[model samples]
Target: MSIGKEILFFFGALGAFNGFVLSLYFFFLTQKKYLSNYFLGAMLLALSIRITVTVFVYFNNDLPKTYLQIGLSACLLIGPFLYFVLQSGIHSIVKIPLQWKLHIAVWLVIIMLAGFWFPYQNYPILWNNYLVALIFFQWFSYSLLSGFENRMLLQKIISDYANAVPAEKWFGTIFLGNALLFLSYFLGFSRVPFVSCITGAIAFTFILYLIILVLMHRKRTDDLFVFNIKEKKLNQEEAFVLSQKLEKLMLEKSLFKNPNLSLNDTAKELGISTHQLSQFLNNNIGKNFTTFVNEFRINEACEIMLSNEKLTLESIGYDVGFNSKSTFFAAFKKHTGTTPLNYQIQALQT
Candidate 1:
């Protein structure tokens, strides 16, 4: 090999090796805290193994037939692992259900059938075709599922946590990266024999390393799953009672009239956890904390704008809990579809 080619080979091997090492790190060191992390670790491990073994097969065609068989056998695992990684990452579940074990048992049975059902030589070709077809189908189906999930997760993160830009960007990148990677893999598969894409494998190794690098740097990447999820924080009766109390507090004390009134402060007044209050808002009322508070401020501003002529828009905005005139104008326009001045003029005319 030329010096440049040798260099590429070295780095490719190094990256794939690092992916393997990172898998162990994720599984043992990081995954203990979350089942999502465990599944992600397993997916990375499967990816690393498949990539490494494909490269091994490509570089060493003279190697034993059974080694190829084992390599092909491991490919059976890749799609399922990716599916679980996506599921566990998005579901926020600490424990995956036992139903998945049935899939594993069935996959093992199919793999064993490949080993013993036919003559070793003929079974290799027939069984490999079955495995490849199954792998592609599994990947395609799960890609669709994850695409839908990624969209939902993105909406949830960006909606409830406006400051979660990093999470949003990372998720968008991950989704794009996976899509591009699979497209590359599928296209490359058609051009060459199943495992002979030397250049493709090297490029894929580099890309997978980039993803793993990002995943490692962002430790709480998986927390995007539960970032805005509405946990069942209160039963119907309790939620109703709390919601009533909150409304009473807002109405009687005019709590929303405080420019800096906060969910935590309100929660304290109500003697409930901040979590319960937040859950009540999202699950019961379908509003975020900012939106809910701003609704009250905007409503108060509207009432003042209509009923009293002495107060200027700025004074009215401040009186209704807005910290700044700009915020007041923006919130007024957002809630009422017009600027405060414009709304006042329109209200007078109507």
Candidate 2:
């Protein structure tokens, strides 16, 4: 093998090993509700598969033509799968429906069957791979776009948190790493295979490192045991002040129109740490960040629904920051104890 091929294989092997270990950690250590764990597992599995293919190609004197066809086809599919995993993870964090899991499972089964049954046919494998890639790519792009929207939503949430907190650095780092990884894969498929593979592996490594760091930080801070008796009293006073400020800011700014708002984003906008914002919301606001933000959104949505007789329910729900009509209705019902349409009807009757 040439020096370049040797170097590529070396990195490939390292990436595969790292991915396997990290995936195992994610699978075993993290809570199952965290969708990122599944995404990590999928990623690690894909990396392991790549490593297997690389070893086969390098050790064997004459690669089976079928292997090459299957390997390339698999690699193309893996790129989009990785993106989907990341997207799903983010959606899960925002409590959104991960409707794509079923589709992903079906596609994986089809791909595996194709690889097993007709492993050598280049056209069939390539065609299926291309079709899956197209679908995955569109979904991936939509997820990224959602992330951008979430940033704005996060800002609103932050404003409601205290107007004194700074944004967490970790989120920015993770977002950048993800973007780089996506770009690397795009470049890889655009003809520069070697560069793409090396860069993509590096990007994956960075993302894993970020996840590990977050886990470590959470562990060190004793995140789950919130009953520190000594600190509780002091924190209570601070929380009260923060909550009042945050609530006032939210009303002033009319921030309920942002659908992707998050507690972390709100904390940053307020120039406070997420922990502090979370504490304030819990102790003073008498609600979790999710509920607090949803309440505001639902209230705004009710006003819009009542005043706009010509607007459809779906349009009004979306216009006021609910990602879907169902979510809007659910949140509205939870907050006001009435369905959106019924509430509107009742308001009109009155």
Candidate 3:
């Protein structure tokens, strides 16, 4: 085999293998039965099939009509579903409501069925290209609208997992990588053969997948979601000062404006460690980072709702760093015993 062909085969096999391993890890090790798992599994399955097809095409010098058609169809059909699964998984992890899963699933099934009946020889590249384009459009449109939602949830998960540090940059990198992957696939389907784009998508997907697995694994063991109880029992005054400082930083720096800001992040910004910050909140503030941050965010949200009469509840919620309007309202009620609209009404009356 030529060098280029060898490289392609190696990377293809590597990507397929990594995807398979990660899918299995998620299936067996990860306790959370997230909808993303379904999509991940499907993606791995598709990748495995693609790898097999690539191998066969390389050796036989002839593509099986059924295999090529099915493989292309599956790849195109699976894209949106995979994207949605990733989207929904992030939401589920952060405890957000995402009702679009079923809708996406229904559409996916319809598309897959269309491909099953449609032969590649008859429709050929155009059929596959059109389907791929539609899938990209769906994924992109939903991503544009729901991207912020995912980021918000991602922020919460990172904060809960990383102690209030912004991991959105990492996740943002993953998103950009995925976008490029989609764009690459789109170009390839168009017969443009964007080699760089293809390689980048594969590489980025693999890297991000590994990063997420590591983060999730760490979060499971480290008690990231809870306060350090022993630390709370030890320090009082220092903890109080640290908590106040953390809260001040959160407010003054407009960190609450970031839906994904976490305590570990706060510690980094304040030139301290996550352990110190955790101790501070636990001992002095008597709450975890999530609650503390939510209190400030909800309060800010209330202020925005009262002041900006033209703003929608969701806009106000998003403006103050809450991921969803529901979360904003829930946190508002939890802290002040009033919904955002009610609070705004009362503020106006007063």
Error of 3 at 207 (Å): 2.8
In candidate 3, what are the lDDT values of residues 24-97, reduced to their tens digit?
A: 75556656555555555565565555545544554455665666665555555445555555564443443324
Q: Work out the TM-score per prediction.
A: 0.60, 0.48, 0.53
> Which segments of candidate 1 are over 4 A away from where they belong?
65-68, 118-131, 149-151, 154-162, 165-177, 192-349
Candidate lDDT values, in order: 0.69, 0.60, 0.61
For residues 51-71, could you state the per-residue lDDT of candidate 1 as single tens digits?
676667666778766665665
When summed lDDT is taken over every stretch of 10 residues in candidate 1, the lowest stretch is 161-170
On TM-score, the leading prediction is: 1
169 Cα displacement, candidate 3 (Å) = 5.7
Better of 1 and 3 by lDDT: 1
Quick one: RMSD of model 2?
12.8
Q: Cα lDDT of model 1 overall? A: 0.69
- RMSD, one per candidate, in order: 7.3, 12.8, 11.8
Best-performing candidate as measured by lDDT = 1
Please give the lDDT score at residue 220 for candidate 2.
46
